[model samples]
Target: MDHIRPLPAYLVQRYHGWRATSFAENRSWYRRLADEGQRPRAMVISCCDSRVHVTSIFGAEQGEFFIHRNIANLVPPYEPDGDHHGTSAAVEFAVTSLKVAHLIVLGHSRCGGVQGCYHMCSGHAPELDEKTSFVGRWMDILRPGFARLPEGDDATRQQALEFEAVKVSLENLMTFPFIAERVESGDLSLHGLWNDIAEGGLMALDPRDGSFHPV
Candidate 1:
């Protein structure tokens, strides 16, 4: 306890402001949520980038979305070799327990993780190639995506990798037996999306054509 510090001044101030305004206004709703537990209809997997606001984009209220954010928003194929699997556990809970109807993987333009992956795959970043680099190891999941990138400049190719991040995650998600069973039974659906951060434009993947269309 002595080693830990209190909340930063800004965060504390923000908490006070929220408690006075939003929390106060939604007192009853918050209480109901606590009493009844959550029943979110969808689970969204998004990037750890602060610019990617999943709740703001969808205008989601607290308790309305079950969100899981990570580097590159990647989902490794189901590997039950008894290791720490945060993303898999979250998915399992969302599908098998929460029974969320939709699972969405949201990727964005100018993602640092994706960019790192591009450089790593290009052999330009030897540091990230080291076994000790967690980001490097994680970005390995996007290697398949990088191998098939379209011919273009770095910017174009990077953006393509961003979309690939979403596609890879969508594919890996199906490797889960629970998710596969639910999808097969029509009880669950999967979606892949890409967001242009500065432009605020969204693109949805047409799985049939393997192309993204504006949404």
Candidate 2:
């Protein structure tokens, strides 16, 4: 007697097709990937926004990028407490373990988390419901972005703060020892990106011009 594995019929069909493709491409592709380990060329810190997927935007093959996602794509300064430090752990693994050469901090337009941060900063922090809501707490990492903004109306200020959060996170990335070492030694380079999901626009910051250009 043989044990029967359980899986969705559609998934089983897809898996079979994928397995056939893999077998034709490389007979031992799974063995190779497992033995060789993940060798990603870049590490991307991006927002949890469903529309701003890194793999689709970058057209990267599977296992070609080390990805980390959080609210507003923040990189908090390294704190040596009992804090979970999920983002820090990802950065450490990408830099120290994977030795990825490139790092990208991605931001996007119309982000609900960024809007929530703006509302919290406007003396409305207490109004946010504490239960079943992690956005308020998760957005604390972007506090510096609000501080950097000039006093203005809600919409103007929120938009400015949202973009500034990307800069803040990029700055925070330097606080990690491994990241800083690699950046200073020219082993790693960091990039900032803004994806306008609604407009279908992809803009990447240009170091030479200090401006974002369409991709």
Candidate 3:
């Protein structure tokens, strides 16, 4: 066995204690939820980053929000193939089946998938050929946005390009028929967000200013 750390064990025991108390006091709350059905208010589209957990960030309980995570948190244009479409399938289930009122695209700083896209577009990445990683295929969806970036190799340009990827995903979200219909009917709202892990702050896209604003 690996080294036994006290921190994780301590956290687990304390967390279970809290959970037990909560469950005891609100046992009917869970039973009532089973009797009824899930009626979450929002759906979150996020990255498959270990550092960014939706339930932890939103302080959500068990059945509060519908969450879907994928490489780079991309929302591809609806195109059905025989292949398994995990992200798109989750979105369809959340929007069509659950009928969530809000769809939040949560982007964060220092995303490895986004960084891989940068390296691939910059021609710095080696040819993987038949050994392509999942990030390669996932970042392929953002190729258009990457190609649209101005020629540069500065840190500022790289950061800007990363944000551009998120903007691209926001636009791609509109490609879904159900999402578009809901937006048109004012039944659903789509929001894009950028979380600064270092600063512990959030920036929301402001159409008026054409920039991200503090949230």
Candidate 4:
């Protein structure tokens, strides 16, 4: 621990404040959650964007939802190769181990990751086109989604691609055999959600029409 630096004064002060307020108010609940283990009914795969507040939108308490955050909230296709796959690993644990009834992919408007993919694919971002860029490689998963987007102006295209990203993640989630099995047996349900960050509006993908409707 000698190499570790001390926490910043502001963050330390904020942590102590939370520990005294929220933690104190929910002391018994927190202790019960720790003792019983988390049995979250839903597993939410969301973007790492600070503006996308999944817990606040759903009013989810601690231990109520298992959240996995990453760039653009994407779920790549299932690949069984012996390699490190963080997203797939999380999905396996959520489905097989946790037995979460609902798996939600939450995408938000103006996502940097999605925009990066958009620019990269459109030959607008040369930096991201480099093979050495980890973000570029990761955003490649969204290439197919971008290709499917209808032609439009920059703003319209960006919004369409955002929606496509959610659809793509939903499709990829089904590529996992375990997930597919549970979904087929009606034990698991998949959902796609897009949040309008500035407007605080949410859109839910309708399974029947394959369209997103404001919710």
Q: Residue by residue across 1-215, what tens digits does model 1's lDDT show?
A: 68999889999999999999999999999999999999999999999999999999998998989999999999999999999988999999999999999999999989999999999999999999999999999999999999989999999999999999999999999999999999999999999999999999999999998899999
- lDDT of each model, Cα atoms only? 0.95, 0.83, 0.81, 0.94
Question: How well does each candidate superpose onto the true structure, as a TM-score?
Answer: 0.98, 0.81, 0.84, 0.97
For candidate 4, lDDT tens digit of each residue in 97-214? Answer: 9999999999999999999999999999989989999999999999999989887799999889999889999999999999999999999999999999999999999989778999
* RMSD of each predicted structure: 0.8, 4.4, 4.0, 1.1
Model 3 lDDT on a 0 to 1 scale: 0.81
Model 1: which ten-residue window has the lowest total lDDT?
Answer: 1-10
Best by TM-score: 1
Q: Pick the candidate with the highest lDDT.
A: 1
Q: How many steric clashes between backbone atoms does each model show?
A: 0, 0, 0, 0
Off by over 4 Å in 4: 1-3
Order by TM-score, highest first: 1, 4, 3, 2
Can you give the lDDT of residue 83 in candidate 4?
96
Q: Tally clashes: model 1.
A: 0
Per-residue lDDT tens digits for candidate 2, residues 91-159, read 988999899999999999988888888888766766543645677777777788888787778877886
Preferred candidate (TM-score higher): 3 or 4:
4
